[model samples]
Target: MIPSVPTLHSERFRLRPLVRDDARALFPTLGDPQQCLYLTRPAFGSEEELWGWLAEPGWNGRTWIAEDGEGEVVARVVAVPTDDPEVEEIGYITCAHRQGEGIARECTAALLAYLLGEEGKREVIAEVDAENIASIRLLDRLGFHRSALHIAFEETHKGVCDVAIYTLSRER
Candidate 1:
């Protein structure tokens, strides 16, 4: 069964479950090619396409949409269980216009607390493209250390790319 997603909050944001209307609210950012540069998927061509993708049913993870004080959707966060029951993988996409405002970092920090505390996850990991410096720095700021395992190359829509794995353990 899909686990229930609880609303999460940070000093400047409130994270809640994603809804259909979010497709419209997030399109300008999620559909931008520049914003999707280091993402696994390419930019969406239209709001309908993004909705279809967002509404697709195969994800076995918890997803949340982060909203700011004005009720604007500023980011999207997700936590997916890994092969090891004690570990969970986390990811986020910040709205293009809201980049550099600490939205992803703040919301993701809240997620880490939930996963490692309430959810009893021993570790939280994030697999990021090696070339994505911003994300690497964010992970560092969040106290995540680079894992020893290095993915030399992985083929994606962006072609062959190196992936860096970062992890934060509950004891850390």
Candidate 2:
């Protein structure tokens, strides 16, 4: 089981576990149809629903909220372990206003370090929509290699989408 992380730091951002109150700040980006298409998660029905999910307890992973120096949430990241014990899958989403600012890259680096160093993780995986060029590129930049593809893993507002799997090991 992945333990709850207190708070992680990067050059320009701080990441902490998502909480019930974050719903309002996160609604605009996470609820946007354009942004929700790539994420497997559906747009929340209400802040109450978001609170429920936020407060739900699970052993798989923890979702983190990235905040700037002023403590305003700027993005979100998740690190969930697959059935494989030593392998963990990670996903990241940047707030609409913060896209293309390398926030994903920076936050992911911190996650990797914590996972590999502090969490004793051996491998990290990422699943992205086949058509999400930017995410594919981001995974590549982070040293993840394409590993497999899942056909029709989920349906999105755009249509049924294929899931592209990528992997990164502790050593390279």
Candidate 3:
């Protein structure tokens, strides 16, 4: 069965379903070479790819478009079930222009609450590049404890960078 759609809200942002039409808004962030630093894929080439991934079935994942009070899409937060049913990894990215505004933190906290409080998920995990101090700090504020640091499995210029693993349990 398909997973239920996820919609979460915070004091300053709302997380809603990511749609194909968001490509135009997403391109600015996704297409930036600097923004793609820690990401697995370089850059999305077309809207079709975005739509196709969002529409895939049997995938236990949901991507939310993070919108500000003005209803402008500023970033995206995603949670996807891993091989272990009790664990899901989370990821988020905000527009470079909107950095330092607490957008990612707000959305991440909201998403965590929605998953653990509403959806009954057990654990939420995140892997961050060691150099991405901003992301690491955000995760820390959300109660994600560091579990490990390892070389990333994905290849990039930073081939063997330190990865900080974080986890939040449902019991918390």
The lDDT for every candidate, in the order shown, is: 0.91, 0.85, 0.80
Residue 53, model 2: Cα distance from true site in angstroms: 2.8
- Cα error, candidate 3, residue 151 (Å): 3.3
Give lDDT tens digits, candidate 3, residues 1-172.
Answer: 4476666778888788877677777877776768878875566566666556556765677788998889888998888888887788999999778988988888888888888877788999998888888888888888889888886544666466677788899886
* lDDT (Cα) of model 2: 0.85
Q: What TM-score, to 2 decimals, does candidate 3 have?
A: 0.87
Using TM-score as the measure, what is the rank order of every candidate, best first?
Answer: 1, 2, 3
TM-score for candidate 2: 0.91
Question: Residue 92 error for model 2, in Å?
Answer: 0.9
Query: Model 2: residues >4 Å from true position, as ranges?
Result: none
The best candidate in terms of TM-score: 1
User: Could you tell me the lDDT of residue 140 within candidate 2?
Assistant: 93
- Per-residue lDDT of model 2, residues 80-118, tens digit only: 878877888898888888898999999998888898888
Residues forming the 10-long window of minimal summed lDDT in candidate 3 = 151-160
Task: Give lDDT tens digits, candidate 1, residues 4-37.
Answer: 8999999999999999999998899878888888
Q: What is the Cα-based lDDT of residue 48 in candidate 2?
A: 73
Summed backbone clashes in each candidate are 0, 0, 0
TM-score of each: 0.96, 0.91, 0.87
